[model samples]
Target: MEMVVLENEPEVLMENISNKDNRDTSAAPGLKLYRCVAVSFGLLCILQIALNISLRPPLNHTNCISNSEDMTTNLTEERDELKRKLDDLKSHQNVLKSERDELKRTLNDFAHRSNNGWLYFSHSFYYISPIKKTWHDSRNDCLQREADLVIINSKEEQEFIQRWVKNLMWIGLSKRDGIWKWVDGTRLTQSLWCAGEPNNHKDSGEECGEIRGCGHDHGWNDEKCSNSNFWICEKKMAL
Candidate 1:
């Protein structure tokens, strides 16, 4: 009986060892599966973080786009305003050109006419008479042509007349009631007289004035109102 009991105890011990080995093997497989699932979840978390960083724009980049749009709008407005100003300038230039052409045409017509031999100079027109007459008659002739005797108002005008007068010529100056005055009712402020002139020779007999010939300084000389001489007529050009 002792021998039989010993044999049974040894079998039971071997069976228990085998069952423990099986339990350990099953637990090892389950632990391996749980580790694989944890690794996959960690990898997914890293990938999601990388995607978020790549997709979002930086703060400065967004501001740069907005500034560029504003600058483009401002430049377009400035360009349009400059174009308008350029168009206005061109229109004014055209008007000035037209006025210049009209003035040139009027001057050309005056140069060719025969009535009293009109001559253009210094923005004024002059008529040189071929026929000689007394001072009063010369003035009356100018009035008939809707003009007046040439009044020498500046040194330039005096020099211009000196070139045209081949002989003594009547002018618009006269001494009235012992006072020198122009035919246009203006007092004389400048004098273009010869030496010792305006003496009213013989006490007021020489009242009218005349541009002397080339022999005497080419200056003015007091003469009798009835003295015969050539004359010059002045009138503004008809615009």
Candidate 2:
């Protein structure tokens, strides 16, 4: 490189440079820059076009748009199914509510019915034909009527029944060989006996129980279940 010192006349130095360089020097540089910009822009556009063609078929517009649409459709179908399940649950709840209301109404009606007192009750009694009965035959008859031996409650209750129970009426109470029990599965604490009754076979062939011969207390006697007598049908009525 050559170095020039500008200590002499500045006008002389300027004049020399002015004559050597062209007056339209700005145009040349501007044109070169424009050409470089155009070449760079053309190369960028060509590269962009080549990249677009190199992409896969699925990256093309149709497949991409269809993929988005399919995703949306699947979401909509799942949402619809969930909504249907929710609706079914609501319907079942309504049905249960209706049934509950119906039950409440029925219960209310029964409550009113009970307030008007028309109740009936029946007690099963062990009965026997005043004639001879082989234990089996008596059991069969009781089964037919859906009833069993009569269980006399209190002493008063026994007397109450004994007055009407003529001849020898079999009581629900009995002794199995030797164990004494009432027909209602209760133990016998009290007994209505004739003076010396239940001497345990003092009477002939007396293996069961019977209510016979009225004492002032309407005592009971263990007798053979044979001998015709009008039986008392023990039942209750609430009015």
Worst 10 residues of 2 by lDDT: 117-126
lDDT agreement with native, every candidate: 0.85, 0.62
Runs with alpha carbons beyond 4 Å of true place in candidate 2: 1-137, 155-163, 182-187, 200-203, 226-239
Instruction: Tell me the tens digit of each residue's lDDT in model 1 across 116-141.
Output: 47776786788888988998999999
Worst 10 contiguous positions by lDDT, candidate 1:
107-116
TM-scores of the candidates in the order shown: 0.52, 0.40
Stretches of candidate 1 above 4 Å error?
1-116, 214-216
For 58-128, candidate 2 gives per-residue lDDT tens digits of 54788889999999999999999999999999999999999899878756644553464322123223233
| Candidate 2 similarity to native, TM-score | 0.40
lDDT of 2 at 139: 46
lDDT accuracy of residue 36 in candidate 1: 97
